[model samples]
Target chain A: MNNADHPTQSPGNVAGIRRQVVLPLGKSIEIAYNSIRVRFFRSLITTLSLVLAVSFLSFVNVSTDVANGLLATGQPELRQALVRAGYDLAPEDRRADSSSKQRWIVLLSLLVCAVGIVNAQLMAVTERFREIGTMKCLGALDRFVMRLFLLEAGMQGLVGAAAGALGGALFALLNGFILFGGQAVRLVPANELLLSLLWATAAGCLLSLIGVAYPAWVAARMQPVEAMRVEQ
Target chain B: MTTNKNIVRVTNVTKTFQLGKIAVHALKGVELEIPTGQYVSIMGPSGSGKSTLFNMIGGLDKPTTGKVYIDEVDVSQLDAYELAWLRCRKIGYIFQTFNIIQVMTALENVTLPMTFAGMRNDEAIEKAMGLLDLVGLGDRFQHKPFELSGGQQQRVAIARALANDPAIILADEPTGNLDLKTGEEIINLLQNLSHERDVTVISATHDIKMLNVSDLVVWIRDGRIDKIESRDELTISVGRIDARNA
Candidate 1:
């Protein structure tokens, strides 16, 4: 008998309707969104860390340009040292110094942000032990689980980066106006602001993905039995 | 009670866990077969390796030695991806703790397996709703796991187990967390699914009451099969004893 005509056939059966199995991106996103919603405070805290880091990075970048400009007129030796260290001494070069010090600051801030992302994701994986086990038992491939986590991290990064960019831009604008008056408008160039936003967002997204890699691998490799044994 | 239609076959399956330097043998060369569409119960005391055997049959774990054949496919030989496909499409699992994702609603929980199987969301939801209705939880679909009663949560779990129309259902202490009456209802539901849907229902449980509905009760002790008894044989044996007493 056909499944539809069979007495035992459940409403759940989409018998005879077959489709090639593709990655369920939409469902994965929805599940990730639901998870974020459920752990709203924890997710918020993690995202906030990214926000603060990105904002700090952007603000420092802008303030350095302003400081370099001031130093250019005051200390010839300092300006020469900064120029040797790769600062643009030319007044038109608003991009300022790509000095080793600035690079160090950027690297340190990113490192801190990356560590925060890893810690948050690791805790999240630990908290969802049973949930992960249940998903594995229900036929979720390891890659599927990994994708879900990566997507979650990406979403957090995207939102956090956007917010941080806005905050940094505003901070730089206000601080410059207070410090340099009317010249502050010209100090924060439109192109530079846009570029900073783009770079910060890209970096945030990349950092988040990198941070989740180890945790996602650990979660994916967990045996269903071992994972389920964890206290809910 | 061997049959040509054996759907699950196990041959000398042994599992060992290396706990630091000590090796703990969970299953010691266990061997068994379960025929198609049968309700088989693995009954044993705690720590007797019944759960380990169940996990083996469900493809959740690999045996240290020997093999497990589900639908004639050597589960031990299958890679992770193949094993995941087998689990997603051919086998369903119910756990003692009712391992429904707490963050999801009953409908969402039920839809998860299908989602992993690459079914579209709308189609999965429709099927999930149907499965919930079949399990008498249509009204509880919107409720989260914590919001539902123990019995209702288990019903959602059962619906989820049936989500992919799997041929084999592996339940590890399916009713362990429920009260007697609720446990009985769950057992009745499983029994009906086995009989009517022709799905093989294999459970590892300590509850003796499960034997009443099981076709074959396999007794296990110390990681070994002590005996295998069919329900009809049990009934006949009971009848003879009652007659002698009379």
Candidate 2:
């Protein structure tokens, strides 16, 4: 009549997931972990697709900008206009002057990170309807529900932000070295690193709130009867 | 006849839900009084407004018409924050599915309401453990809902309902999902809570076995009270076992 009815109670019964693997919040952490893991995969697909799209745009934009800058550098009339633009056929100095291109790429990455985080957070919220409803039935107020989900997003955001910022900085640093070969190069852009980390956290919070709004609203509006009616 | 001693008073309460263009009347002109320390069961077929009544009494929903009073306070008039406070301090709920948080231990589930009541974490955990022990889940304190059987889960839920020392425990089909033997165990637990602890227990269920544990049974048909029967009198009218089947 009691837990003796549980099939999993018997030892040697497949030795499934042990009850002892307790996370800090245990089940909530598992739920959040699973949800974010799934989101991480989905974000991978989204990021890859976005990279392709942005790469094409970047090639076109950079080429066009460089051509325009050089053309503008030319006087109204000049035979050997290549030298007139001071866009030396030499690749070294030209690359150094490519700060404008660096700015454009960084801006694009920022846009991509924003969209990715927001998309991931929104998807996570949509999938947790029953969880949110359960919280509400347990007497969670609207703001309390908001805070819990926001915490979930915050956790994921922290991970994603840290990873993304570190990844961007490391890549930029490596590329700076590669571009300069054995020569001196500013591989550590302290300002860019700081800016990206800040942006990462902000993006995380923003996306999480955006993602959580729909689910939070759904949770707040649930009637107790309706909430309890949800099956596993 | 409303009395000051009534813990819950519903006066001509009505509830309506608008689904797109159609309006659904969940409860119609329902009036009732439940004095303190009464174990009452509400029974009706689907759409009979049984759960609707429980919802209104628990302050989970607002009545479209009339009013709901808890301890003479018009809970229907309270704002969302006020209703939440009342729910935390005065009401406990048990659901058919057990509705225990899946990720939380039995003890944690029991202490959830206290957490909302703003108790310190350690205090809530200690009290929750005490409640779990009281409900016979002492050995299963760290067990999750999925780890417990149906009856044990319901016990955890009962412990949870008693968590805040609430005046009233509102349960919707607390035993509907359990096997007969398990259901009986759950009923016994609830009955003990009502009789021994003097907690006002209001349950909405179709389970005849559950009615055997109730002090009073309120039968509803078509959103109105069809009959009210006292267990002792009903037992006298027909033998105890037969009365339940009847």
The lDDT for every candidate, in the order shown, is 0.80, 0.64
Candidate 1 residue lDDT tens string, A1-232: 2342211223243232222223567777898888888988888998887888888777766656554444635555645544654445684553465567767887898899889889988988987888888888887778878988988888988988888877876786677667556554554455666777788777777888888899998888767775336244
Worst 10 residues of 1 chain A by lDDT: A2-11
lDDT of 1 at B41: 93
Question: What TM-score, computed on C-alpha atoms, does each candidate reach?
Answer: 0.85, 0.74
Scored against the true structure, residue B146 in model 2 reaches a CA lDDT of 81
Question: Best lDDT goes to which candidate?
Answer: 1
TM-score of 2: 0.74
In candidate 2 the C-alpha lDDT for residue A8 amounts to: 35
lDDT of 2 by residue, B1-246 (tens): 232267889999888989999998888788898877878988889889887888888887789989988877787556555555566667888888777766667877776677665566698788888888888888889887788998898899888888878788888888888898888888888888887877889999878777667778888888888888888765553465576777
The reply for model 1, stretches above 4 Å from the true place, is A1-21, A64-95, A98-102, A227-232, B1-4, B235-246
